[model samples]
Target: MRDYLIKATAFDGQIRAYAVQSTFLVEEARRRHDTWATASAALGRTMTIATMMGAMLKGDDKLTVKLEGGGPTGPIVADAGANGQVRGYITHPQVDFDLNDKGKLDVARAVGTTGSLSVVKDLGLKEHFTGQVPIVSGEVSEDFTYYFATSEQVPSAVGAGVLVNPDHTILAAGGFILQLMPGATEEIIELLEKSLEKIPPISSLIQQGKTPEDILNLLLGAENLKILETMPVEFSCSCSLDRIKDAIRGLGNEEIEQMIKEDNGADATCHFCNEHYHLTAAELDQLRQNGELQ
Candidate 1:
């Protein structure tokens, strides 16, 4: 099925939940970045979580998630908006390692257990809202769960997973986030904890062709979940050639002239999507004449 996420409430709105099947979305990112097995898992997990978080917003609101773990992969950055746009990159996309003791992708080894996970939200306010927390686990899900409980002060359960194929493609990718609202009873929390314990890993469920609704049922019980909305998700980049040209123009006339003199042209590549944009010498001259190259 097409990649999409579902927002829902359970137990009469005391429990807020989100679930998504992001196989195609994560596969697109892997193809764009040419990420290896471990890197694919790491990036896929982050993207899966970011897509769900993007659903939390309305209008043009957007957020950027940064995981700066001092590991082989270095830093992982992802941006998502209410419109379901997302783009991300890893400092090192070729990093790979042997599976962990659990026979799973060694994400912790690739992402490291040290550093922090930070989220910066552009809520259209004078000052954006930023929250951060130390990486409790190099696994992306736990780190996000920690961010919510410690930084956002919301009790949450977060689960994300990505399975990579032997050919270095994505096999499955998906996740879920469930939060307990105020007035949540102790009985409800206990029931949720039990339900979470019995549910399979999100990646495994996706590999089994389980849908987002299946994931929610696994977490909140089949009868308790009340579907609210479903939103399509994908790997989308907002970068364009014009945006790159504007950036080069902002480098000032001196820099533009130096480029025209030393190099016949200029080339720019977006880190998020790896899209290359080339600026011709004639175009540079025109920008200069128009005083666009301050």
Candidate 2:
């Protein structure tokens, strides 16, 4: 099935929930970065959660999630737009290790048990919103769960999983986020805690052909779920040749001339999608002239 996200409310709006199928996007990331199994799991899980978090915004709002665990996988950065578009990259993509005792990818080892997860949200305002919290677990999902509760002051359950194949491709990737609204009753909270314990790993469900809607229904009873919106999600990057040119222009005429003289051109690469942009000597000259005009 095509990658998508489902937004819903349960228990009469006391619970806000989101679920996403992110296999295609995760695979795209793995292909671009050539990440190994453990690194792929770390990157995939972060991107999966970022996609759902993006759905929480409106209009032209955007957010960036930075996870630095000081592990072999290094730092991970994910950018998401309100329109269900997300792109991410890992500082080190070639890190892998044997499966953990749970028979799962050793994400915690790859991500480390220290460091922090910071989120910066641009709400189209003068100042951006930022929140951060120490990593409680190197596992992406638990770290995010802690981030929401400690940084945002919202009680939440976050679950994201990526199953990597022996060939280093993504087998499955998916996730869910459930938050309790104000005035949530203790009875409902207890019920949710119990349900969370029994729910299967999100990636396993996706591999079994479960839709985002079906995942939510299984987490929060179908009878209590009220579907809000469905949005398509994908791996998208905002970098382009024009933007690269603009950045080079901002460096001023002296820098532009130096690039043309020393290197014969300028090369730019986007970390998010691994897209490369080359500016010919002629193009660099034009940008210098454009800078003079401005």
Candidate 3:
């Protein structure tokens, strides 16, 4: 099935929640980046959480998430729009490591335990929202949990995971975020805490072919859960040849002339999607004469 996300509320609107199934999206990222096992797990986890965070926004608003753990994987950069579209890349996508003591992917080792997780939101009106927290754990999930409690000052329970096949492709990927809204009673919080303890790992559920609603039912139960909105999610990039061409033009006519004289053409690649765009010498000449990229 295609990837999708669901937004819901529980306990008479005292609790807000989101759940997502992101298998194909994460797999697409793994294929595009050629990420190894541990790298795949870390990147997938970040992308999963970032996608859910994107669902929290309104129209035309977007957010950027950065995981600079100072490990071999370098920094993980992801951007998501309110429409459930997300794209990201790890600076070093080839990093890998052996399983940890729990026999899980060694994401912490690959991601490092130092540095921080920072989020910047473009909310329009010449204003932006920023929140950052020191990395308490290199594991992506706990780091985000800390971010919620400290940076955003929201009492939230976050869980995200990605399972990689033997060949390093993503087998399953998913996550959930449960947030406490105003007037949440102590009883409601306690109930959610206990319920979370009894559920299986999110990745395990996704691997077993569970939907977002099934996962939400496991987290918040069906009786009190009210599904609000559901939207499709994917690994989508906003880069194109025309955009790259404009960037080349912005480098000024001298740069374009040099490219024509030395390399015969220019080949540019996007950091987010790794898509390549080439400009031939003839094209460069046209751009040089046109003044503005067409």
Candidate 4:
């Protein structure tokens, strides 16, 4: 099935929940970055959580998630917007390691345990909102849980998982976020905690053909959840040749001339999607005339 996320409320809105199946979306990212198994899990989990967090925003509002774990996988950065657009990259996509003791990808080893998880949100205000917390666990989900509790001051449970095939492809990817709203009753919290402890890994559920709604039912109970909206999600990048050209122009005329004389042409590559753009000598000359090749 096509990837999508569900927003819902349970127990009369005292509990806010989100669940998403992001297999296709994460697969696209892995294909673009050529990430190894461990790196794929780390990056995929970050993307899954970021996409759900983006859903919390309104039009034109967006957020960037940075995971600087100081591990072999290096730093991971992801951007998500309310429009369901998300793009991300790992500083070291080729990193990999043997499965952990639990017979799962060693994400913590690849993601490292030292550093911080920071988020910057553009809420359409003069100043963006920023929050950060120490990385309590290199496992992406627990780190995000710590982030919400410490940074946002909201009690939350975050779970994300990605399973990779032997051929370095994505087998499954997805996650769930549960937040306790104001005045959440103790009984509801206890019920949720119990449910969380018993459910299978999110990735496994997605692999078994579970939809976002099905995930919510597994977590919050089918009868208790009130489905609100379903939004399509995917891997999307905003970078383009035009944007790259604009950036190149900002370098000034002398730099453009240097590229033309020394290199004959210019090549630019995007970090998010790894897309390469070539600027021919003729195009550079036109840009110089238009005062955009600087």
Off by over 4 Å in 1: 291-294
Model 3 bad stretches (over 4 Å): 291-294
> What is the C-alpha local distance difference test score of candidate 1?
0.91
Any residue pairs clashing in model 2, and if so which? none
**Superposition error at 226 for model 2 (Å):** 0.4
lDDT of 1 by residue, 36-153 (tens): 9999999999988988898899999999999988889999999998876788898899989999999999998899998999999999999999998898889999999999999988
The C-alpha RMSD of each candidate to the native structure, in angstroms, is 1.7, 1.7, 1.1, 1.5
Candidate 3 per-residue lDDT, tens place, 1-294, comes to: 999999999989999999999999899888898899999999999999999999999998999999999999999999999999999999999998888999999999999999999999998858789999999889999999999989888899999999999988889999999999978999999999998999898999999999999999988889999999999999999999888778888889898899999999999888888888888898888887765445
- Tens digits of lDDT, candidate 2, 212-237: 99998898889999999999999999
Error of 2 at 240 (Å): 0.6
Q: Write the per-residue lDDT of candidate 4 for residues 27-120, one digit (tens) a residue.
A: 9999999999999999999999999999989999999999998899889999999878899999999989988999988999999999999999
lDDT of 2 at 259: 97
Q: Residue 225 of model 4: what lDDT?
A: 97
In order of appearance, the predictions have TM-scores of 0.98, 0.97, 0.98, 0.98
lDDT values, one for every candidate: 0.91, 0.93, 0.93, 0.93
Backbone clash pairs in model 1 (N, Cα, C under 3 Å; residues 3+ apart or in different chains), count:
0
Report the number of the highest-lDDT candidate. Answer: 2
What lDDT does model 2 reach? 0.93
- Deviation (Å) of 202 in candidate 1: 0.7
Better of 1 and 2 by lDDT: 2
Worst 10 residues of 1 by lDDT: 285-294
Candidate 1: residue 13 Cα off by (Å)? 0.4
